[model samples]
Target: MASKAGDDPDSLMSLCTIFCLKNLRRTMCYSEGEQNRLQLRPDVFLPGEICDRLVNEYMDLVHTDSDFEPQDGFFQLFSDPRSTRLTRLQLREDLVRDRDLEAIGKQDLMELHLTYCSRLTARGLRTLCSFRHSLLSLSLFGCSSVFFRKSGAPLAAGEDEDEEERLQRHTVDLDFSFQGFNRLRLLNLGGLRAELDVEKLLRPLPALTSLDLSSVHLPRPAFLTQWSERLASLVLYNVELTEELIHMLLQMSRLRHLDISRENQRTSKFKMTRKILSSIVQSLVDLVSLDISGHIMLDNCTVPAFEDAVGRPSIEPCKSSIYPFQELKRPLQFLGLYNTTLCNVTHIPAYKVLSFEPILRLLPQSSAPVSQHWATWALYNLVSVYCEYFTVKPSHQIRFHPKIMSFSV
Candidate 1:
């Protein structure tokens, strides 16, 4: 018997509804697959309407996909108390290529290290600098772009236009001023040979503690006199060293560590004399460490005699008055006399020795033949032991072992 049309209408409606549902399910599956392929992580869930608003407002600056996201483990490593307040961000050679740096904004950044970043350029640096106030510490070690001009002659003195025009033309250079960092402590401009206005650069950083200008040309000695006494450490790698420069550095009475290794080179024409070096050393009454190695002048000089003479008592008459040069009252620890032609092992100074193996090898003919292999092993062990012990306490009981102390015979 055939069913009536009205009675069968409910069953027909049910069949149509099932077909529509199946299509809707397929569409939903396709949409999900597309979303997954995009590789978006679970969205950062906002707690309330207020949070949602704030997050949406700054969504572009925040939210990163899995590849761009900062690893939790890496973040945890830098979450220590020592590294927490570290406003200076160092982008090492390994991390420089990472795209994650784009996510890092300069909200509280004070310093930045872009050492050995061959790919980094002035344009990118300008962009990075725009995020923060003028960076306090800007390290561009081994970065060639920073030192040399890309094209054309160096920016001339209004050779092209008026003040407004010049300003517009060199907006990037003007904005690259270091004036914003009044509390800057350290600046490492190693390998930069640009004609930087040292006085202008330093004027902003009144609280600078350390300055490294290795392999870079600096302004006149007169300019260094203007440096603040807060400077505790200074490294001059391979630059001209004059008596005036030495005197200017002497003005920094609070300087504790000074590396004038540039003066120790064999090919260096401007060799600092024993008298000048000794005078400079004497002036730094508070100096706790000093390194002057690789220079022919120092190489030829008698190490023991030089050390003893520098440390000896001497009465000298000045233009106005006379004063006695007493032994450096501050413990002159960690002296690096490396690459010098000093042969006598017994003459080596008795401070916490880092490397005596080199000196041992150069000992007199009477001394036993030093085993090169044993010396290498001993040096490694000494460094390891010293580092371990020092890591525990940086300032106390810094001593050497007898085994490492055993010179030749």
Candidate 2:
């Protein structure tokens, strides 16, 4: 017996509510933007009406997946108050059309995350300007084709034909504008390759405090002095670390967190020298966290002095030692040193007691020449740091170095 379209569960609104409640409840604990996968069956498409209905239902249920939970009290206690007012729409790896997003523009969306959405054109992205006033964060990670036109608005007739002609000839020179996001605070443009005019992009977004440009091949550093004072967190992962780039970054006086981990040896000249470290430490007085991992040249020559400045306990410097610099003014809380040539044991500086809690993560390099003595020293240092703040684990390889402290692996 063929069921009527009105009677079908897929078409009925009641079934939509039931299906959403069931699936969303399973993953209710995950944050709005945290769930990466949606188990939609392949070779089948949800009816357009159903899709629209689901989108609306999901937007409405942004506050809570279901009233009852295993830990109802705990869930309510930590629930976001703003979740009820603003919805977060995450559409990833989908063939989403312009109309699909245009419909979404009607709601007050706080966050819009679109990853690998190749079908969403430049025009589709521009359409989002309609709700720009309410939107707080927008992440378009790995959407390569969508771009910003240099001259954002369309050219008027009989006015600057030469400029239009040049633009037509060099369409590749186009870039995205940051006009819509007036209240945007966090933006992630990871894996986007374009020559972005930093000054122009940041001019409109004065409230923007956090930016992630990881794996995005940025053009030469320019106009960083403009918003350098406002940015609190920045990620320049795998970017070429030049002296000029460092100079540009140092201008950001209010930056509290920074990650400039150059994983690949893109160029031999890319070295984090003692001078550069000193400049960063001296300039960015508010820096609380930093990561300069994966740079081979970041050895004891620079790391020891930096550690000491930021409050690391007294540890012996390497054979090629550079030492006892001015103590760090800013209270650094976290330091990362994974896959670097720098010996973990050495260069742990003497931090001011009770001023701030510090955490140092050090994983030995695969290509490093490991010796018994070096391993023991590393182990000892790790134990000393661990015991200072945290309890030592029971299962361990304990060893006492004659010169250094006792450590366990």
TM-score list, all predictions: 0.56, 0.57
Work out how many backbone clashes candidate 1 has: 3
Candidate 2: regions farther than 4 A off: 1-86, 148-176, 195-202, 266-268, 298-326, 346-409
Give the C-alpha miss distance for residue 285 in model 1, angstroms: 1.1
Q: Give a tens-digit lDDT track for model 2, residues 135-185.
A: 788887766434533244542221223333423432332445777688898
List the pairs of residues colliding in candidate 1.
Answer: 264-294, 264-295, 265-295
Residues 1-409, model 1: lDDT tens digits: 5556336875654444333223422321122353332211233221333222222222222232333332222222222222223354555442343222333442345566776654443444545544445456667676544322233334323332332343333322433555556656778777663555555545666667888877666657566655646778888766677667777887888888887664235557666455665576677777766766544453233434544444322212121011121244533454544444431323333243233334445446775444332344455466556665656343433323332221221
Kindly give the number of clashing pairs for every candidate: 3, 8
Candidate 1 local Cα displacement, residue 37, angstroms: 9.7
Q: Candidate 1's C-alpha lDDT?
A: 0.47
Which ranges of candidate 1 are over 4 A from the true structure?
Answer: 1-88, 94-102, 128-138, 147-149, 152-175, 194-200, 298-326, 341-350, 353-409
TM-score of 1: 0.56
